[model samples]
Target: MAKTILVVDDSASLRQVVGIALRGAGYDVIEACDGQDALNKLTGQKVHLMISDVNMPNMDGISFVKAVKQRPAYRFTPIVMLTTESQESKKAEGQAAGAKAWVVKPFRPEQMLGVVQKLVLP
Candidate 1:
């Protein structure tokens, strides 16, 4: 079966782009408008990986990652922060929150796919 990836971002266009890329790479994609929406989508489902944006309206990526880590069912799920923020402090914060990788925006589809393949649960 294909790995399922949950993508959380406030931008519809960004989600669409990521969805297309993942689909093309033979992975299934679930999209959420923000952190809260992503959490709601995770109910009793198996998500192989997650890609989230750092800044959002309802909840930020770091907080979202922290929330996921607190959940026993999802604590081991790999999360990647896809955002514009490149600051060391922000990256450290994401790491502290349990994100496995960081991908800056304007990313190449190939690069994102590479990371996903490496991190997605088998």
Candidate 2:
């Protein structure tokens, strides 16, 4: 089966960009505007991986990661946080919240695909 990825971001442009890249790499993509919506989507959908932004309206990436890890179904799901800068404190918080890795924006499709490939296939 094609791997499913849930992408959560407040920016429509960023979401579209990431969605297109994941789709081009042969993965199923699901979009959510914020962490709250992402959690709602997870109720009925199965996802192999998740890509989320650090800053959002409803809930931020760190909080989202914490929520995701709380669910047994999502405990092992790979998540990567997309951010504009590499903040050490934020990265640590994300890691503690159960994110497998972090990707600083502006995201490169090829580079992100490579990270996704390794995480999903490894």
Candidate 3:
């Protein structure tokens, strides 16, 4: 079966663009507008990987990652943060929250796909 990926972002355009890229790379993509929405979706679906944007309305990605990690079922799920912020502090926070990788905004499809392939199921 194809790997399932949950993509959380506030920008509709970014969600569309990334969703297309992930689908092109053979992943089944699920989208959420923000952290709370992502949590709701998580309960309803089976996801293999997560790609999230840090600064979002209503609960933000950092808090979302922490919440996901708290859940035993999602503790080890591979997560990557996609955002414009390149601050080491933000990266450190994400790492501390259990993100497996980080991708800056304006991500290339090939680069994003590479990480997805490495982290998600083959």
Candidate that scores best on lDDT: 1
Local accuracy by lDDT, each model: 0.95, 0.90, 0.91
Q: What's the lDDT of the predicted structure labeled candidate 1?
A: 0.95
Error of 1 at 46 (Å): 0.8
Ranking by TM-score: 1, 3, 2
Q: Order candidates by lDDT, high to low.
A: 1, 3, 2
- What lDDT tens digits, residue by residue, belong to model 2 across residues 1-122? 79899999999999999999999889999999999999999984678889999899989989999999999988889999988849899899899899998999976899999989888732
Misplaced by over 4 Å in model 3 are: none
TM-score of 3: 0.95
Q: Which ten residues in a row have the lowest lDDT in candidate 3?
A: 39-48
Better of 1 and 2 by TM-score: 1
lDDT of 1 by residue, 1-122 (tens): 88899999999999999999999989899999999999999997899999999999998899999999999999999999999999999999999899999999899999999999999998
**TM-score per candidate, chains pooled:** 0.98, 0.95, 0.95
- lDDT: the better of candidates 2 and 3: 3
Worst 10 residues of 1 by lDDT: 37-46
Q: Could you say which candidate leads in TM-score? A: 1
| Model with the higher lDDT, candidate 1 or 3 | 1
